[model samples]
Target chain A: DQQVKQNSPSLSVQEGRISILNCDYTNSMFDYFLWYKKYPAEGPTFLISISSIKDKNEDGRFTVFLNKSAKHLSLHIVPSQPGDSAVYFCAASEANAGNMLTFGGGTRLMVKP
Target chain B: AAGVIQSPRHLIKEKRETATLKCYPIPRHDTVYWYQQGPGQDPQFLISFYEKMQSDKGSIPDRFSAQQFSDYHSELNMSSLELGDSALYFCASSFGLQKGSSEKLFFGSGTQLSVL
Candidate 1:
């Protein structure tokens, strides 16, 4: 079963506009969530992460918001750039669970310049 | 500046053949994890090792086996491969075993295996 799910298969937005990607999880035991960006033929790179204790975390132009009650989280990229076009994956791991991350199906975001 | 390294970027094998995939974790990193991503699917955890010891297990098939060596590198051996075993296998590493801050994984480019 897929514990984490990214409902949107793909998204498109204009450059310099805001882009929002959403993810949902059914495993309450997961306490840490992270977002990764991957390019074609390359490994995924870590973008940002948030703890279950915090509702939001921001770094540079990327922000992650978490809603524990809704079992949902989102990543927002402000003034999206063309370089931001890639597949975004939402991953989660339970505290003390050997740090194995369970990942979502991923959402491909395309930024048109 | 070093990142995880996985050898044999691409491999083509026939059914019932055996293949071995290798991974070199980042310098000073003691934990290694393996994941498999099938077509149009999420990355699924397979197994993990810390300090040369098996720490966790996932949906790994019995036909497959893995081990970590003294240098902190890892290898996955697949025997009697099937066509369905074709997928992208990724190797990731972290500094700490279960540290909160080390939750962010540094992943390798992945090894694509095609079974004919």
Candidate 2:
């Protein structure tokens, strides 16, 4: 069973607009959530993360929101640019779970210029 | 900054054959992880090592095994390859084990393995 799920396979947004990607998880043990962006033929790069302790974390134009009660999380990019277009994966790990990450099926975002 | 490096970016094997994929973690990194991504699928954790010792494992087939060496590099060995074994294998790394922080995995470009 897929513990993490990114229901949206792809998303499209216009440049300078806000882009939001959503993810859900079934495992309640997961306490740490992360977002990674990947390009074709390249490895994923870490974008942002949020611990279960908080409801939100932001860095630059990237912001991650976590709702533990709903077992859902979302990544928001303000003023989205073409460079932000890529496959975004959401992952979760339990602090005591030895760092084994459970990944969601990625969401491919296209920011049209 | 140096990222995780994986060798033999691509490999092909026949059924029942064997293949070995390698990973070189960043300088000073002490943890290494292995993941497998099937076509149209998400990455699944296989195994991980911290300080050259097995720390965690998940969804790895019995035909597969992995180890971390003293230099902090890692290798995933797959035997008895089957057509289903074809996938993109990714290697990731972190600096060290601290406060149970296993997130923030820096991944390699991955090695695509094709089994015929």
Candidate 3:
């Protein structure tokens, strides 16, 4: 069963525009959520993360918003750049767990310059 | 700085053959993890090792096994490989066993295995 799901398979946006990727989860035990960006032939790199206690976390141009009641979260990139084009994955882990992250099917983001 | 490094970037094997993939965690990191990514799907966790001990095992079959050396390097071994085993395998590492902050995993490029 897919506990974490990213419904959008792909997204396209113009450079300098805002880009939003959404994710949903069914498990309530997951207390931490993170976003990762991966390029072709490369490993995924950590982008940002949020704890269950907080609703939003921002780092530079990337922001993650979480809604516990709805069991949803989103990653937003402002003024998207061409370099932002990559596959974005949403992952979650439960508190006290051994940091094993369950990931969602990635969303491919393409930024057109 | 060098992140997680996985060897044998690509591999090809026939059914029933054996393949071993290697990974070296970042210096000073102690935990290592293995994940398999299939086409059009998210990465699925395979197993995890910490301090040379197997801490968790995911929904993988017995044909798959892993070991961590004293130097924190890890090896994933697959015996009697099947066509369904063909996928990209990633090795990740974290500083500690903590859940949120100290446990951000850094992944290697991955090993692409094609079983014919």
Candidate 2: stretches off by over 4 Å: none
- Model 1 chain A weakest 10-residue run by lDDT: A93-102
Clashing pairs in 1: none
Q: Which 10 residues in a row give candidate 1 chain B its minimum summed lDDT?
A: B96-105
* Candidate 3 chain A minimal-lDDT segment of 10 residues: A92-101
Sort the predicted structures by TM-score, highest score first.
3, 1, 2
Q: Write the per-residue lDDT of candidate 3 for residues B1-116, one digit (tens) a residue.
A: 98999989999999999999999999999999999998778999999999999988897789888999999999999999999999999999988787686237899999999999
Per-candidate Cα lDDT values, in order, are 0.94, 0.93, 0.93
Q: Write the per-residue lDDT of candidate 2 for residues B15-96, one digit (tens) a residue.
A: 9999999999989989999999999999999999999999988999999999999999999999999999999999999987
- DockQ list for all candidates: 0.73, 0.68, 0.74
Q: Name the best candidate (by DockQ).
A: 3
Name model 1 segments beyond 4 Å from true: none
**Candidate 2 to truth, TM:** 0.97
Error of 2 at B19 (Å): 0.2
Instruction: Tell me which residue pairs clash in candidate 2.
Output: none
**Per-residue lDDT of candidate 3, residues A16-46 (tens digit):** 9999999999999999999999999998889
Q: Candidate 2 on A1-113: residue-level lDDT in tens?
A: 99999999999999999999999999999988999999998999888988899999999999999999999999999989999999999999876886788999999999999
Cα deviation at A112, candidate 1, in Å, is 0.4
